[model samples]
Target: MEILPADLQLYLETHCDIEPEALKKINRDTYLKILKPHMLSGHYQGRLLSMLSKMMAPSRILEVGTFTGYATICLAEGLTETGFIDTIEINAELEELLNQHFKSTNVEKKIRLHIGPAAQIIAGFDGPPLDLVFIDADKKNNLLYFALVLEKVRPGGLIIIDNVLWKGKVYGDAQDTDTKLIRELNDSIAANPQVEKLILPVRDGLLLIRKK
Candidate 1:
């Protein structure tokens, strides 16, 4: 769900750095082939994710969702030479598409695709200190993922949570399960003392939390 007005979104995209040719192709293919094309990070949010990743210059990154591998590739933009990203996707069906997308990319060597339940993958993860994490998976498990990720993220590391606004349902009196869970997670994160957090109204809404 686009939180920004269409014209405003277009203006923002126009002003931001141009989307890379590889990313543009992925965006086009995603819309043509994916079931929920909106889930793709698209142009603006993809640039934001890339910018954040570039800013962090993390040695190790964990992404909880790998929808179409758009954001996966974006986040890889700023990884150190030895840095690598471990992105998990529950749908094994997407593995082929993701692999195909990563095959010719420069970040291919820096990406490790995991096809399984994010919880299980994260629980067993024993990688180096995580410098950053991106959570864009099941809304109900947002807190669970946050807690799990917080344990592995080093001090001062960052965790990015997507869809926190849930297309404006979070502010309305929508009693739906996803909305309630997202609202609860939002409240919980805001109250948590372990990290400093801020929500950016980009795309659906991205919550950036830095471990303290």
Candidate 2:
């Protein structure tokens, strides 16, 4: 249920910046070997994530979903030399596949994959406040995850949420439960005074929030 026209999508891809050589390979391989290849953030969004990460130079990052590890790797690009990224993926079935690709990349040391419910796993970590948090897991628990991580993210840190647009169904006549939930989450972020938010039209929709 893509909201963008085919021509526009193609144009966006063509005109936007491309990913690095390693990311290019990972992106291609994920599509060919992964079950839900579309979940992999492609060139445009990947580049955006990488650029944001680089700009922030975060010491610690929290990724709520690691669907094939594409976005995880992208976010890791901006970490400090000794920094780390704690990424969670509920699907244990993709563990071997994700590990295989992760091992093949240089950022493997920086990414720690946790296989289980994100909320529960994140609750157990007693590490330093996260410099960046990317939420792309279950839509129904978006707000829950946000609340759980709110304290974990330091002031001025970034929290990025994906699929906020829900294929533009948020503004349409009617939407399924997931779409409605996403719309609600967007509104919740918009109304929250503790953070500054910006919703970008990048692939699907990405909400960038800076904790205050």
Candidate 3:
């Protein structure tokens, strides 16, 4: 759920830098071809991801969810010449769609897609410390993913968790599984002394956590 009104969202999009041509095409295609296009990060969030990546300029980025590859491409913008991004998506059906777009993008060389449970895949990555980590996959596993990636993320690196608001259900009376899980994750992050966090009510809600 959006925190701002429609007019405000439109104004924000108009004022921010637009996404690259390739991302635009990919986003459109994903919405048209995919069954659940809403899962793909649209323009505004994509631009935010790109901006964060640019600011971090991380050498290694680990993304827990790679739905349609929109955010993957956005995050790839911040990589150094030889930088790399490892993105994991549990849905095998999106593999072909993701690879199709990945092949057509300029940052194709920087992204590596892993299809499987992120929990298992993350265990095998023995690479260098991550400069940035994005968690947007299974809601129930947010804390699990965060713990798994914490060891790999460099000191002061960033960890962005998407869908923390759960479409305003977080603040409502609903007690569904996903809602409870997100609430637990949010409270845990807030209480954790290892990092500093802020919940930006942007597109659902983005929890920006910085390792201390």
Residue lDDT tens for model 1, 55-95: 99999999999989999999999899999999999999989
How much lDDT does candidate 3 score? 0.90
Runs of candidate 2 with Cα error greater than 4 angstroms are 1-3
- Those runs of model 1 whose alpha carbons end farther than 4 Å from true positions after fitting are 1-3
TM-score of each: 0.97, 0.94, 0.95
Error of 1 at 158 (Å): 0.2
lDDT of 3 by residue, 21-50 (tens): 888899789768877777777788889999
Query: Which candidate model has the greater lDDT, 2 or 3?
Result: 3
Clash pairs, model 3 backbone:
none
Kindly report the root-mean-square deviation of model 2 from the true structure over all alpha carbons: 1.6
Backbone clashes for every candidate come to: 0, 0, 0
> Which candidate number maximizes TM-score?
1
Worst 10 residues of 2 by lDDT: 1-10
